[model samples]
Target: MSLLKEAFERFAPDYLERYGQSMLPSHRRCLTDISSCQTDALDGSLHVCQSCGHEHYTFHSCGNRSCIKCHHLRTDKWLDKQQDNILPTRHFHYIVTLPSELRPIMCSNQKKSYKILMTSAFDALQKLASDPKHLGGKIGAIAVLHTWSRAMIDHPHVHMMIPAGAYNKDDDTWIRGREKFLVPIDALKSIFRAIFMKRMRKALPKQIFPQAIWKKKWSIHINTFDSKVENLLNYLGRYVYRIAITENRVLAVSQTTVTINHNGEALHLRGEEFIRRYLQHVLPKGFHKVRYFGIMHSAHKQTRNRIKLLLMNEVIIPDRPVKKKSTRCLKCSSTLILSISVLAPRNFNCQASVHPP
Candidate 1:
């Protein structure tokens, strides 16, 4: 057995049983896929590869979005899509973290409240940019949602990737900003808070906004400019595949304690008895945890095309697979039927007829 397989065998089953209830619909489907790929166990040993006669056994991964057990292809595709989307100009990553005081309302009304968060954030950006006193342009941005901290704390925030420049409505030209493209912090905070409050007062249930938060107001944090966007872009790529805690990142799991590795430190912590606390932060089925707004929107992607043309730093995207002929059978030269084709843990089957008339 491979080293990974042993670890998986020890951890996967328990992990699933303990936390599977909170997995997203899409993640649950991956569970089914993993279960289907599992081979029958004979006295705790697995099957061999028939053609090569090689194996003690190979165990498959769940590949669930929340599992973080396997993310190779997932990361690859995500990177591929993003490669050409990068603008030639400088990019800045703005992390906007809403206060934990609002977690109750945000978590309970996740979909509705998340939508409000998006609206408020974008409105804050648009309203600020439209001001002649500021950059005075329609600034495009990509906003992604991240709803957890390292140990699965329920934190909701938006990570915005914005181009260095924006459209100048008055001049009919793009207004390029300096490398230090930071919005006025105080202005951004007030606008973000106001927009959110305005939305909540209109759309949310009375119970959602506790008297404490409503009176005191939640805090909004806008991180300092990321000097080199590459650092933060790479950060986003890694963050996309993150789960609460993976076996690799987990020091140990005991009866009463879940030992975790975070910030390069190992610490054993416990208290929340139910697995649901962590799992609650798992994204909803098929819900995109990362998203794109502004010019990245589907309706405005043509605008993106024009921007690429204007930048004149076009990048050729990679190719995708097309239907093709199958590998012939070894015993007889006949077309093979593809019984299965799996993306990971490598499964493929083909058959051929004895004779072709």
Candidate 2:
């Protein structure tokens, strides 16, 4: 069992009993799923070895996006799908962060706030890139939302990967950006802040925000990468299907406390507090944390193809070797054949049987 799952099994019951009524349905579901993941609470399949006739029963995973036990395959599949659409040019990585003062409000209104944050950030980028002083053409971007800091604090931000160029549809030409700089950081910050505040007001009319946040400078980081976008995409893929914490990061889980390794430092928290922090990062049901905009949008596939054709000689995406799964039997070192079964009950168990022909 994963340390995270063990921690949840130990602490989730008491936490839920104390605060179940106030918890979001998604959070409640996450707790149940993680606690029962890859266990008898879920279904299982039977596998038989071809050589030694060893029968192994494997339980199904919870499939919950927040569950660390699941989504490894899903993340790989996402990266493979994105590889085809990646532009063959230098890209800029942008991190747009929500101010500390707005975290409470954002957490309270998760779905709405997260959606607004992503769109607002992309809108600012599009607005700036379209100006004649800048690239002056339509730019494509992939924006991903992250809600947790290294210490599992609620820090909302969007990471955007944008190719350092634009595609002008009018003339069917590609306009490359400067080698290092994409846009002025100060100007981008101003535009992003104004757009986010305006959208927040329109989305939450009744909520009042502190005026000081408007005056204070928001944190925005811009990083430049060469034509190889695989690294950037891989970094973004890590957060797409998983939640704040992972099983490997969990150092120890005792009856009363959970300890995690954060930035090489051990941080301990009470079991209940650990559960609280983990649940806080479970996004609302059906909320998409990764989004595409402008030319990167699915609707603009034709445009992207044209851009790729124009930059075919210059584009260089490294060959990504697919990681194959091991199907060999552990007991006999022979091939294992799988046969999926219908959903089984909690007590369901499979005895050793011959391999089915």
Highest lDDT model number? 2
For 162-204, candidate 2 gives per-residue lDDT tens digits of: 9999998898999999887677778888998989889889999
Give candidate 2 regions above 4 Å deviation. 348-357
lDDT (0 to 1) per candidate: 0.59, 0.86
Per-residue lDDT of model 1, residues 1-357, tens digit only: 232233334444665776578766644554444344333321122333344433333334445665544565566567656655755556666777776778877887787777788768877877887776777777766676778777667888888877766666456566665556546667887888888878877886575455565455444544333335545565577667754544466666555565667778876555233244445666666566676766656666666666666666522333433324343344343443233322322342212221120
| Whole-structure CA lDDT of model 2 | 0.86
TM-score of each: 0.69, 0.94
* Predicted structure 1: lDDT: 0.59
lDDT, model 2, position 309: 93
Clashing residue pairs in candidate 2 (N, C-alpha, C atoms within 3 angstroms): none
